[model samples]
Target: MTALPRNVPSSTDPHHLPGVRWLRSSYSTGANNCVETTRPAAGPWAGLLAVRDSKDPAGPALLFSPESWSGFTAAFH
Candidate 1:
């Protein structure tokens, strides 16, 4: 398990997060099914989930609560 960063701003607006470093699985090459995640180091949005597509950084992101993301990841396993 990894800890979310503490600097994310509380905005569903998606513009508050800057310098978001997205990472993709090594197995995701050439697939449209790519996903990425980032966390801020401090703010109201800290600890929130920022899920996005590797194909589109400027695209909309899916925000999730810690519990929600946990459940979501569990479902796949």
Candidate 2:
């Protein structure tokens, strides 16, 4: 298996996946605390989850493989 790439660009990388729209959680509305997310347009990470802080759109993003994102969501639910 190939090693994952590091030092990805802040906005153009998974941190800001090109063409992948960002969305804020419905739970947020005029609140200081909110989470935003996006996903790849194609490839293995096509549907993988990319998360970041709403307060900092240009900040580093947390990439989670599809399965990992699902498990995280399930565990919290």
Candidate 3:
């Protein structure tokens, strides 16, 4: 697996990321099959972005650097 960024939180339970405001893209469809993202406002995870499947709020979250996430999303734009 690819290595995650320093200070990034990796958890099997989304609840591990407390105080995060998970939000789906405005372009998401009503089907609710989109992913959600949140940048931790405080704690050790602050500054890193957390992402999880909207359909599975209690599932694992993948962490990424803001730059990394920008690069990934830029590919589709």
Candidate 4:
């Protein structure tokens, strides 16, 4: 299993995270069923990747390290 990122912040609320611009996958269509990801450039959550459901922007997101995320997603391949 992959390791979690260091300094994981307590706030998982997507809106509360500062200066984040969520991005959707290029493979995503307008259906809004896929997930959105953002890399916080500043604040406590910076240096970690944040992901949230496309259907709920106001909902909480899960944070992951770049390596950890890759390990998690690699299972699909």
Candidate 5:
């Protein structure tokens, strides 16, 4: 079987993902307490979505597959 690449960032350091464009939801309040997501356009992490806490842009991020992210949002809807 082929081994899967490590999609998640090694740490909560935003610097680890330099150049990634993190985007927060339009519904986010001005409080700056929301989660942001970005897709790695290139590299081993490409195709995976990265999510991080808006309060801590330099913090670690959690990676998810497109299908998983869709199911997650669907559950809330």
Candidate 6:
């Protein structure tokens, strides 16, 4: 059986994602306390939107499907 590599990082944590680009809302101040969003381009997490706390980059991230994320924001909009 194939085994996962020790050096390979997992998706639960944003810091583990390689070269991921996180986006922050422009309305948020420069305090870096807001959450960040990024779309993972590959891996098992690919096609899912990843959200994480900017304050704690090493913290766990929340994954949401495209439809779910849209509905979530629509409520606020």
Please give the lDDT score at residue 53 for candidate 4: 76
| Per-residue C-alpha lDDT of model 3 across residues 1-77, encoded as one tens digit per residue | 13454433434344467677788978789687888888887676778788887777776778887888888788889
The segments of candidate 1 whose C-alpha lies over 4 angstroms from its true place after superposition are 1-15, 30-32
- For every model shown, the clashing-pair count is 6, 0, 0, 0, 2, 0
Residues 1-77 of candidate 2 have per-residue lDDT tens digits of 12232223337554346667788999988674898887778644466677887888777777777666777778878
Off by over 4 Å in 2: 1-16, 43-45
Whole-structure CA lDDT of model 4: 0.74
Q: What value of lDDT does candidate 3 attain over all alpha carbons?
A: 0.72
Weakest 10 consecutive residues, lDDT, candidate 6? 1-10
- Pitting candidate 1 against candidate 2, the one with the higher TM-score is 2
Best by lDDT: 4
lDDT of 1 at 35: 80
* Alpha carbon lDDT of each predicted model: 0.63, 0.67, 0.72, 0.74, 0.71, 0.67
Q: What is the full ranking by TM-score, best candidate first?
A: 4, 5, 3, 6, 2, 1
1-77, model 4: which lDDT tens digit per residue?
A: 46654433334554457867788977789899888888888876677788887888776678888888888889889
Return the clash pairs for model 3, or none.
none
TM-score of each: 0.65, 0.71, 0.76, 0.78, 0.77, 0.74
Backbone clashes, candidate 4: 0
Candidate 1 overall lDDT versus native: 0.63
RMSD (Cα, Å) of candidate 5?
4.5
Candidate 3 residue-wise lDDT at 76: 89
Kindly list the per-residue Cα lDDT of model 6 for residues 1-77, writing each as its tens digit.
Answer: 12221222334554466568888867669898798888778767677777877777666777777777887778898
